[model samples]
Target: MDADTADIATIGHRIRHFRTRTGLTLEQVSDGVGLSQSQLSMIENGKREPKLTVLQSIASAIGVDLATLLVAEPPDERTAYELELGRAQASPLYTALGLPVVRPTKGTPTPTLAALVGLHRELARQASKAIATPEEARRANTELREWMRARDNYLPDIEDLAEEHVKASGHVSGALTHREVSVMAKHLGFELVYVNDLPKSTRSITDLENGRIYLPPASIPGGHGLRSMALQALAHRVLGHERPESYAEFLRQRMQINYFAACCLMPRSAAVSFLQEAKKDRDLAVEDFRDAFGVTHETASLRLTNLITVHLGMRMHFLRVGEDGALYKGYENDGLPLPTDVTGAIEGQLVCKKWSARDAFTQTNRTTELYQYTDTPAGTYWCATQTGRGDDGGFTVTIGVPFADAKWFRGRETTARAVSTCPDPTCCRSADASLETEWADRAWPSARLHAHILSPLPTGAFPGVDDAELYSFLAEHSGPLGE
Candidate 1:
């Protein structure tokens, strides 16, 4: 059969399966769907193609989604709907409800579409359930960070999980090899396939039922980076995260997978031993960790932050800044002053140019570490920064600690000291005198609008997902909400 005909037949089969599974007779389902028994029979027999609305009604009557019925197999419907619902819950209206969204399981019966609509109606009647705010993103970050801090940024459970995985793979204490990743994928019944036509934001897509993972080669770096990315994808399946109920939960899930990936790349015991040995003579350098673990600078810094904060009892802040001095990413369990928006967001805000995180951009050598001491309104902080220019752009990674805590770091002896008066109008390091005098009339740098910054505010999982796509999703699911 042609693919379209086969699809219709499959959808028809699903309708019948769900109808029988739910123990609804043709007459009963037809009555609920506003269709006669004969018409319903025709649809279930694949004689006629149901319209989208008709399909939705059928799905609702059967306590499922239209997309669920459209899947080739009923067993896979749960997974597919979960993936879609994950994106759907990111909508501001759903998020504002603050209800824990649950995915329907085979054993747990879902209410019919009408019942769910009634529930939504009751919720709306009691009080409006919709409140959209940009600060939701900030709140998510704060929640996840607080969770990380509560555990002292150490995840023993995930580390144990990774250790078990590594033991099963017959590999001990080192970066996972490409051959090992492939072996692990096969062991988990997954076939790895590479493609080039994935969305720019997507590095990989997993099809659990099909036991396939689609990796976009161009997006993934080579060597150890590739192995790390592959292991991360496998880690998601191994960890078995449910669909996230909130943006904060989504961030937490991502971080969990990240921690798992880092553990796989640099096993915790070995990393700790190495750090302990290295710290005996010299302060910890991010590059040393990167080289030892065969990971990138960002990965190394994150690993160091996790290791020191959780294992060593040292609280520090990590930063990634672009050449333009925009804060790309940051995490702090330490009480250090970092840049923030009015909403207290760290990402996308401009870092103080005098800060080591930004000043490293001015250094000619991108690889060498640039350490500085800055006295902000909060307190003096010593930071070690290194810049790297890649094909994409130039960016710097910095690890900083409060001045009182700087004695533990290797770069604490650097004479590059700057008294930064940030977030204060009367601060000594204002750009007005030097920068304006040198190029006020010459440089006309326009403020750039980065849509990705706002994209994460609405979407839970992936940044840069167009808002219109999310709007369309809401419109499609409007019937489920009784809109």
Candidate 2:
């Protein structure tokens, strides 16, 4: 209504945001500010008008300034667009879009101010959606992953940009070299520093302000790890990845950066040519590519999948699991069943112990390859996986193709057949009778590394990346990762 009412509303909103952000309850704020919890809640819900003294007391209790509590940020172009979009989407005109109609919150709705408050409430509701509920995150991730799989996980535009950058940096094919990275870093006005103690969960930290990129010293000794790390960090800048506004946008950006890094290391044209030659003998393998190119097994495995899916037009699936058989990442276009949660997500689900990925983890003195043929409700498929350890932890990477498509790979000879009825009781791996009979209550599966797998990541972007560690690092150094 009036300026005073608007300011009171803004103060209430800010106080609520701060309290929620700091994990403080209404009771705690009320107790500290000498107000009843009901009064505090009413103020927070914009149903009660609070005095200046009350606002100041609440601000002090929340560890923020009185002015900050009263003044709301003026929405920029993007925010204004989102607010308008939310308001419009809430209307009947855009009902087909299926976004929930933001109901007007109860209070007196003055003719003119009612519309503004309705829009404001709708904007608040939409802004909260950006944080993502668990279901929202799961659905968004599944949709994005499916979208990537539908396109065969190959982004031609991103590939072209990466290839152009590589050529411009003076590298002429094969795998990208360390020298190329150094040259590009210099061109981008960056100096690389190999630090031994750069946070356990972090691989590399880019200090754009200081014009220095920090790499774990371990990445430098061998394995072309240094180049991969440098290129990934540089990809954020070269690709102009924006600050992620939501979980889905964050996942898309991370995938783009990874795609860019992979393209730089294994050029699309060169990789397609190599695959064309290598597949002639039915000998296509990640190890073969790893040796042919100067990349690690993990990189080679991902690169091969990228090429085979896009270039060869074969639907495939890739899975990465730990020694404990937890699925770290998985993608499939082939109609083969993989373990998944109730929400139909493959990630974070425990792999069927009989599956090739888990089998690879148990092999003593395991060779560079482990292959298995699995039969599921959809059909039979053949998978080849390799187990490896790294700074973060140990993991196994498996690539599977439909039975019809397995003829193109060497692992087709393996008769190690298994049937998987995943997320089903009759499935040999998940059968309670089978497991209880074998271990008889003696086995332990490590209590399921909860790790907030089902919850929305606090940073609201980058599905698997540890944004908290990066934030802590940046806070310590007084620097920002991305604007």
Candidate 3:
């Protein structure tokens, strides 16, 4: 009936149930309890809290123990429906709608009660879902990134698993072949199947019962190739991930699978040895690393992030920035301070325009990687950014290290360098004095916003996937496995 009485609604329902079961009328119970009949009715309807003596007298009059009336569960399915309806009507969302609350009677159909309860549940779910703001998502992402950073971005256990699986696939070389990936899948009791009608929300779907992994036949732009994606799907099973219940868990699982994929493609011992040789030659280059591993530049850069610090004795930083200067992903144990929001999230925060990650977009040499040294408040750092076009737009994958470590890397002595005192607006974000004065009041520029930056992370156990669509896809595809 009201917020104050919401907690005791179940108690009211129980009292009514026990009273009716004993065939005691409201008037009879009130008479025995020495309260007005209206008072008894109010208590039964969850509109009033009867005193301890009044409750004792009611229990005595109804021939039941007080504990029985105080039990948590509704006495029956019908009472459950009534309790749910009362809760819905008492909620702030319902009251704020300014709609008349439905008071169900004995004559009200069971279907009507069921429908109202279902609608109320959906309303509450939607309300809760909306409350998961971008800030919450960023905080989750930031925390997960911090957790990864804590271990120097190296997971020896995961690395061991990747090495064992790769060796099992009979892989002893450079790039992990598609055939080797298939071998690993077969070794793990999974078969890779390509389907055109895969769910849009999912990259790869594993039907565990049927021992199949369904993927798209076509390659996705700015995404992992078939081998990497397959390895990732297999990684899920290897890592023992169930459906994630929160955004943080989802991010972690995603990172783990990607990490596993990287480790598989570039096994720990081999990749580190390759880097060691590159360092000996004073010619560490991300492009050569990408070429050697036959993986994307971003993938190579990320793999380097995992190994360079732990194995190569070099503190480093990696950044993936969009053409619009938004920092899409970043990691650093070196002192290059990434711009962070109040929540310590780096994604969606703008990288300094003076940084090589942003300036690479202006470079005329599209075929070659752009390398530069940036002088920041922290120190001078040498970075190489490779600009590429994706389905969304242009982006850059940059890997960098402190000036001291630059001696071991290629492109260490380039004339291209700039100063950045970022995390300060005047460093890059603010317009020049003449430009600001001329158009500060005249400009009414509309911001081109990314929808994901404002929207909540998708709701449900698996986060962004549609359960019904995935289940149907799995069922449709599983029939062939039996054959």
- lDDT tens digits by residue: candidate 1, 1-483: 334333564677688778888899999999998999999988975679889899989999999976677665434444334334544555566678697875444474343433544555565443331221346666677667677767767888889988777767777655677766777788889877665554454566666656766675734556766677677788888888876655656667788888998887888888999888777765677878888878888888888877887667678889888877788778877776677777667767777777888877677776678888888777788888888776658888888878876776788888888877776744534567776799978987877665556643434344434545444433443342223
TM-score of 3: 0.76
Clashes (backbone N, CA, C under 3 Å), per candidate, total: 0, 0, 0
Q: List the residue pairs that clash in candidate 3.
A: none
State the lDDT of candidate 2 residue by residue for 280-302, as single tens digits: 87778877788777888778878
TM-score winner between 1 and 2, please give it.
2
Clashing pairs in 2: none
Error of 1 at 111 (Å): 21
lDDT at position 224, candidate 2: 76
Q: Cα lDDT of model 2 overall?
A: 0.75
Candidate 3: Cα lDDT at 442: 95
In candidate 1, position 250 carries an lDDT of 65
The TM-scores of all predictions, comma-separated, are 0.64, 0.66, 0.76
lDDT of every model, 2 decimals:
0.72, 0.75, 0.87
Instruction: Write the number of the candidate with greater TM-score, choosing between 1 and 3.
Output: 3
What lDDT would candidate 1 get against the real structure? 0.72
- Global fold similarity of model 1 (TM-score): 0.64
